[model samples]
Target chain A: MDLAAVVVYEILYTIAFLALISAGLAVVFGMMRVVNLAHGEFVLLGGYAAIVSHNTLGINIFVSMLVVAPLAVAVFGVVAERLIIRFLYGRLINTMLATWGLSLAMIGAFTLIFGPTTTSIKAPIGGFAVGDYSLSGYTIFIIASAVGVVLLIFGVLKYTRAGLIARGAMQSADMASAFGYDTSKVYMVTFAAGSALSGLAGGVLAPLVGIGPTAGLLYIAKAFITVISGGASVVSGLIASSGFFGIVSQAVTFATNSVIGEIGLLVAAVILLRLLPTGISGRFFRDRL
Target chain B: MTLNRRQFVQGASAAGALATVPSVAMGADSIKFGSILDTSGIFEAYGKPMEKAHILALEEINAAGGLLGRKVEMIPYDTQSNMALYTQYARRMTRRDKVDVVHGGILSASREAIRPSLRKAKTLYFYNTTYEGGVCDRNVFCVGTTPAQQSAILVPEAIKRWGKKIYVLAADYNYGQITTNWIKFYAKQAGGEVIQADYFPLNVSDFGSTIAKIQKAKPDMICAVLVGAAHLSFYRQWAAAGMKKKIPIATTTMSSGNEHKILTPSEGDGIIVCQSFSPQADFPSNKAFLAAWKKRFGHTNDIHEIAASSYDGVRLWAEGVKKAGTLDRMKVIEALESGIGYTGPTGKVTIDGKTHHVTHDMHLIEVKNQTLTIAKSYSQIPPSDTQRVCNLEKNPNDTKQYEIKI
Candidate 1:
């Protein structure tokens, strides 16, 4: 209702959004040891897809996610694996190069298709009014959906057969293959799922943020910051790092200007990363690493 | 990574050999004009259209009995929207291609990068886009509105029309920061105060926090300096936040009619844009220009404000060449410095001989429904001799304002 509440609301919403994106990237890097630079493009594709579906087909923004989110990530994952990523197994530099190339190509292709313009997807539920402080329905949905996804992923990886195989492959790919685990299929499925998570983040955030061709650059940096800050255990670490960064960014912006806020957060991120190479949460997941 | 003597010698020899070639020789053929554009990257929306306009202008110029009794030849290179590539391309154009004059650079950074090269090459450069000015080079002619031309005029009018409380939102780049500074300075001069100022990177998409801040500030009007497709996003988000009706939006860059092509009608409606060119200008030259552009591009309703300026740049350059009766860079520069006025599509174009900056009519346009209609036009604003004043001083940042004798 007041200024402080509004600032708090902004800080929380931003944290939730950032955490959702960073979670998928953290998983891919922490669990699979693949940087997946094209991860941001998957999000971009989802955002664009949401825009198209909403504008062209006149579908409900929330429902369009069902078609766009999974499809974008799956398409990227399949194509990436088939053309470039499959060869990058166990080679970090090669993986980085391949994914970086894929990122540039996708950015170029999307810009050509979408005309470098920023387009918006409508909020599914508009806004929920509470006294003088109104929260966007889309933001609420994003927060809820991201929480749901984090839980779902936690459940799948903790209690499921496929996730166990993924964990095994992540630990030692050669050993997992020697033990009759289909490491190739595991890699494909993990990449696809990671990409799908990114897409879901994009789809949900599309209404809240405008979709543009080069919009992924900042997010990619932010996601990396989250991943590195979170350390090796992808989900929880990334969530915590995202929250931390989001709060810092909001606080700085509130204190001064947005530009200074961004610069300050980035500088802080660099210093923190340097001091804690394994990251803030890396100590908790030492056994996993 | 160290180079051996033999390798260094070979590289030096190649460079020397390349330098010996005469770039601007008259071969009883077409006169070559160099163009550097961002065919790829974030600025492509502005760059591609500009390239198209340049080509179209060259075509029309050639068709109408070429400049200097020779058909005009355009040698265009894509910078890919990188500053390094822009410098490289500018060098290649002047040294390798031997273009008589150079035109292009949608972003101010690109133009700034190529300035030293332009001075060294002694090539006449026609900068054809709106910019934050304070630059005055003998070799360069700025064909776009300087901060004085756009913001100086817009801020006062905006403050008068929509109270004195203002919010300034700009892109976090050279153009944006400089323009915002100019706006702030002039807003204070006009007895208005900037309640808040914020900036976003060129590619920023989310405006929720920024809009929230603007709402809290409750400024009478918001002055935006965003460029390209990003404006569409800002407009939609601002409207969605319910601040569009509460605060009147005034922008130096975003209110251009070209934005309407990308944004929905509702998103663009009621925003006042201060610019040199508007698609709704009812001049005879503009009518002919629009018709020709539509015919060539086969796009009926998507002429950006920059297109007319670019077209005017080429036309003005050609006129200078004709008047000078030579392709000599110095001669062309002298002719352009004559402060000659030309009737073009956007309106009467006048270059300040002293500033090398073009001063023209500034249009205040409002988007009504879907079409950009001219709400008002401020014409004959005397071009400030800031360049002349600054040229005499060592530091351009000196707190001195040139008095207009008019």
Candidate 2:
């Protein structure tokens, strides 16, 4: 029936949303072991960058979201890694504290510029009819984007020399350095890549949520939940956890309403963590990335 | 003699006590009007304008030769959108600053947080924000449009224009919950049925699934009671899904914080929002108020329902003080209870002596190019919903927010 199709679409969209938001955190936390608490703020900055470019500079919405937001955030990521994150390397607790402070500073900086009001651009795509029901065409774009991003990450890590070097550096910096690789350069590039993914997620989701100074709070908890619950294997774990949480949340949302849906997602995450502390990937996808 | 530790502390304490005496004496020369609002946080959109409105009102009152030959001094406190600070500042304003009268509490929770303290201190409180109404406190005056004054008029009008199957999407809070009930009450009166009602927490901005759900229900119209910055997304997402053109929408909380301006012209246009005030209201006093605001603040862009109501609230309190001829708490209360009214930008806001609430004119407005265009005006709708439960005359000691059961 039309209802079933719409529900399935919603479930897929939710999964895509979770994956998109968590992809960057998975790379930074799971792969780098850095635990970037400012992951949410990085996403927030991307949204603001998209809005500023599209609304103020009169750039095409798609171009601003796709190119400008990620590039801007990637540049910031490089600077941040150089100035603060570099010194805090190999110190997990210190990185968390430093990133948390960075998050607060980003929020303050954003409020100074944007003045605490919600700002957003209109969704590029309009709704299209699906049988008897109509849904946002942007939903399809988001699902596709999520798929592309996951594949892109997977392809790079599985094939490219840079991705191989980055993975090797993350696994054993001493071994990679002995192989004549600059581990520092690898860390910087990996961090920037993670930040860019977060930016892309923020840009894609901007039309739905509208960007504000405190907007990061909405996605931070969910991103952390998804990434942490996914365990150590970045791509496979992110996919697995995002899939489980998103389906549970969206199905509950459809059955009841959004409040209970959110509660349901949180409850599922809690139970999942209790049962498998190392996460879904820890137990199931042990050797898969 | 060498000073011991206890004697040295006593000497410093005495000096501190002596320093406070002169400051307290200086403060007594002018009547202190305390204003508390969240001027620097997420709620700043609602708070900053309200603070400006209060200043304008106070300035106007003082410019008219000072109330009772004594200058009204403002003692403003920024609550910073924190509920705990509301209580902290309320106590400070009443006990430390000893303000004669206090105005400003943006959220209903903020008002509730400080209302009892103000009542205990007998500092004469005025909460000037549109909220769920059922407070029967004789000590406080609520000068905002309640559900009866808003939803009772908006729902029926929307039902008459659109079809009968009304879909409700309200925020998950007392304001949204109670307002949705009022909408239902009025919708039934107009022979309409709510096809579905959904509640969203203030932070849930994603509405993709909800949009699909709405399409499935196929309601004639959507009645939104959403609030805050996050809830603004529903409007954006609803339009993005191209549902705005297909189904008309009506809301009770739009334009209060200038939410219409936040959305783009295409997205916001054709949405109906009923409120107690509109900047476009054709009134001489409104024009003057806007002119004064422009002259003082350099722009009238931020003037909205709650801002305008805040202006009227301060003016009404000044009127009560002038009539009483003294700032005595009981005397001013008596004067206010004598049906004090002020005709300002909102058009004749009169205190309902019975419930200590206000009866004001409501305007049904449509958003056109990011501006509210007044389509129809209903005059002097009382807080009938609160009136049904609250009777301050009979039970003067009553201090409870009664939730109306449908």
Candidate 3:
């Protein structure tokens, strides 16, 4: 393939990956009102688990992810809720400190256990060619799987009885409980689902990006920016912001240097966020809030 | 009763006299050696093994009856790969721990960061890592090859082989910027011109756009100075982009012991890495070093260029101390400045007393089937001070001249 086509294909694939991460973060925040600083660690855990399984058991990448993704997120959800996150339900300051500490501790623990080295997973499906343009089969799979997940989530929330109860609980916990809803169970399940989404995203992304202990630091900042810009509402705001930010950043990097591109995007985002206190999509959710 | 008192006084005097006898028996004492390194962080892959090598060298020397008949006690501290922590640990080693000599540092930034503390404490700092060198300090003895030693040999050979319309891709940091400058200078000297230059952040994963620009530039060869796993990512993406056949890639700083393990054999093939040491270099010293290393570490993991250099640094310091017949810091410094050659794992290394830089053989290696094969070895390159415009020999203690060439 020619160079231009290759660049376009890579940028699209990266955007789709970012959108999945942002959507996962948006769901948890929207329901629980908890800022999960340890979210990136969970992603790293899933990636490492997949890498270990691939190297040791000789399992295919997709098969490994099927086992790793749900287990990582479930473990993280239970530990986070029981040990620390429970105390920070209403206190933002407490949540910030506890989660930030959790993030650092996780980084240290992983480095000690795994050593500071980069690990990779082989692409499950190889590349395919269409005319003069070549595309990675794994990249296409990532895009399709993410879309399917989003659609599945949208359906569950819109049509299922459990989905209605979840929406009601997020809007008003006391009112939902007064209406005979099991708010605690709903909260637990929502947190687990959000964590699971992050794990799934990491598993799919292991081949595209190599996993390192400190790799989570880079993604966490961008994910937080996407979540804040999207107004921490339903997954729609997240999907929109992820696409917008990813494309802008990639295009700017193509036009100039990556450092300059990052600076420009971050500066613009910060200014827009300051001007709009609630966020870019805040106006749409004003009546609901 | 009076007789008993007199006997007691005489006995106490005799005991005091015996206590001072050992001091006279042993006139001098052994010197202490301290090392500060990142034991757990991003750079630990380089630093941890380096610490192990230092300890091994110390054990070998002390087993041979110590330096100047004084046992060498090594005290090592983990810097955790943080710059602030490096300074704190370095100071604590010199002032509180009172080590007579110091060694160890992996990153050029970390080395530069700890310089002030090394100076203020007046402890002799033996920097063991290869760096972008122009530094000359009374307290600092650089044992690794500078950019001049590395690039002066590599660039000319590259230009001789490929008509040098060169392209530069580097990490956006001090080491990358300065090393790229050295390449540009040497490339120009060899009647070649650089067509394009680009810098990327340290953690960049995607090289699709950067590779596109490189392809558009259409240079005869590209010189890259990226380090760590980032190099692996860049190589995979570049190869997948199909730029490998069109452009030949070479790097002075990218190849290290740790990097080879991370990248698959196929991904790293055909890339040329110029370095001070290669595991495949045909030297008896290197063969022994590798054997001992594998036996102890339980794998054939290639020791990093800096780790061997650091190991050599400890041995050289021991030799200097032995030759000087004293543990006095100034005497050891004077001995090191006497232009002596030491047989080391890399090869025979000669220290330039005037420049305070070590000159040695450099190897050009190509990655083939997951193994580093030697392409060629350049035995001699001018010391860094001679290549630069300034005369560093006139003032060995001058700090300003260190930045000019580096």
Candidate 4:
């Protein structure tokens, strides 16, 4: 029974892991339709920011992750938007090319500054035993943070004025502009928020996994798969897709090993994409978001 | 402007001599030592120091009046941790540049990728990295300690100190796969048993389920054959789960890179490891090498086992060249096969001519507060694992890597 509990916890943790990593891309690519190929690098940047602040400046680890990492990446996102991304708006291929270049450049910069080895911070929380298995307390924190981030994204998008304006601007920019709202500013803030969310994921995961310059490659594919597999509506699609992929991957993983489990995930993605041409949200939450 | 045939022939002959002079004369007059390493990407942490060690050894050889009375020239290439580029660069070094001897290849995969090409080109190749044993190429000298040198000592010592039930966590590759066999071999020899052995790919960072599985199995200790930067997470994750207190860990793959220094003391402390070289080893040869490296590089922070092995490899090759008194490949191989030995940073390192592998004084060390402390020293552990399968003297044409099959 304890083994079963641990398995269930692991499944939930995997789901949370997917949701956290995909949330940023969901905002930028799903809602904004920006096609950010460098979303992974942005996460890497956030990881470095948190690590640098925590280790060098002696800031608290949580503060570094929660406050410094996201804020730093958000600032980077704003500058990136103004300098490069602003011009490539609406040009999908161009944005991809530009962001791909940006990712490479960010990786280079990271390698130059941080060196090749991974910089790791100690996990703040300790472990607790449930029956026969002793599980990492950090897992619970990650799941909680993932839930909080999703609800926060949902709340801001659905219940707030800025969220409403941002959604309207994304849906119909010229119409929103005619109604006396600035679409460009909204897009910029949304992109910044997206970058910030990526940073948060990176920061939260810093302790669980060490972050190197090229560490972003590990997450980029999985994040893109989750976000794209979710399709149009950002929050609903993210939650639903995270739920589906996370459960599938973890189930296979528990049944066998990680290698086959990863194969199972890609296979499931192929089958899922074939069946629901849109996504889970495209079918179920089509009218909600 | 109509030139006669004889005049044109004379002009062509002059150009031909000039073309031949650079390739033939340069090869004859200087020792071209080619080095290929991943100096930029993820493997740079290992590669940079190895590169520096190569430079340092070449510099020392040149200072000592060169090898065979000719100046040693180093031709270095950074493969940037790409596997395809390793073969590409190896070809360029061997064919285009025509380097006499080549050293460098960190991963076993990288070694295999370039080993065939180097053999085809007749370039003397040296792969100076710790790996699973049984590479029996006559033309190549693997300078790093293997599973025989590491697991033979580490597994038994761990069993003696910790307990008999061992849980194995290893990277999913040839190195990890074969090393796990050696660990099992040694564990059984010591009247111990492996409860569970898990294989994780180099890219797999999360060890949540694996850790739980290990705990459920209720192993007394863990034998971690994890590799690269990504696998460093196992230590962090293990510590985070408070497994550090519950169960101890021993590793054969901890110190080849900067993974030990990368982890915090809380995360890295009390892990048992067996390596051939450590900066903490107090020996004259080691001290001199460290001094020279510090002088050249301004810090000894980047020094690791592979780097030390690389330094030893270069010096060992130079010894063979000195004994043979020629830049000829076969002659040097014969001289090195006569069992050349050198006192290096890791102490007396001898070439096991039969297997074309190194014999080293393996150190049993423990990671305490992010630094390695030598607990006990074992001298001159031969590549017994490779020797069991590979006998180059009996079969000189042997070029196969014999994996240990249980």
Error of 2 at A65 (Å): 0.4
lDDT of 2 by residue, B1-406 (tens): 9999999999999998886677598877888999999998878989999999989988988898889998999999999988889999998888778899999999889999999999999989999988898988988999988987888888999989998999999999898989888888999999999889999988998787898889889999999999888999988878877788889999998887788888888789999989988889888989999999999999999988999999999999999999999999999998999999989999988999999999989999999999889999998999999899998889989999888887
True contacts kept of 1: 0.16
lDDT of 2 at B60: 85
How much lDDT does candidate 3 score?
Answer: 0.75
Candidate 3's DockQ? 0.40
lDDT of 2 at A214: 87
Query: How does each model score on TM-score?
Result: 0.88, 0.97, 0.89, 0.95
Model 4 agreement with the true structure over A55-168: per-residue lDDT tens digits? 999999999999999999999999999999989889999999999999999999998998877898999999999987888999999999999999999999999999999999
| Distance from true location, Cα of B162 in model 4, Å | 1.4
| The candidate that achieves the highest TM-score relative to the unseen native structure | 2
Off by over 4 Å in 1: A124-135, A159-161, A168-181, A267-277, A284-289, B1-26, B228-233, B255-257, B300-302, B328-331, B385-406
Model 1 — TM-score against the truth?
A: 0.88
Q: Identify the leading candidate in terms of DockQ.
A: 4
Q: Whole-model Cα lDDT per candidate?
A: 0.76, 0.91, 0.75, 0.90
First chain TM-score, candidate 1? 0.92
Candidate 3 Cα errors over 4 Å, as ranges: A1-7, A124-138, A284-289, B1-28, B120-122, B159-163, B229-232, B240-246, B300-302, B385-392
Taking the tens digit of each residue's C-alpha lDDT, what string does model 3 give over B1-406? 3568879999898997787665435533656788888877788788877888898798888888887777887888888878888877887777666778889877777778777787777788888887777776767778887777777877888888878799988888767788888888889999998887788788777665676666667788988888666545777665554455667888886556466656666556777878878878878998888887787777657478888989889988887888788777778888888876788888888777776678788888887876678999878555664336434457756654355543
Ranking by TM-score: 2, 4, 3, 1
Query: Which segments of candidate 4 are over 4 A away from where they belong?
Result: B1-28
- List model 1 lDDT by residue over B210-301, tens digit each: 76677677689999888655445677666555555667888887633366655666566888777777778887888888888889989746
Clashes of each: 1, 0, 1, 0
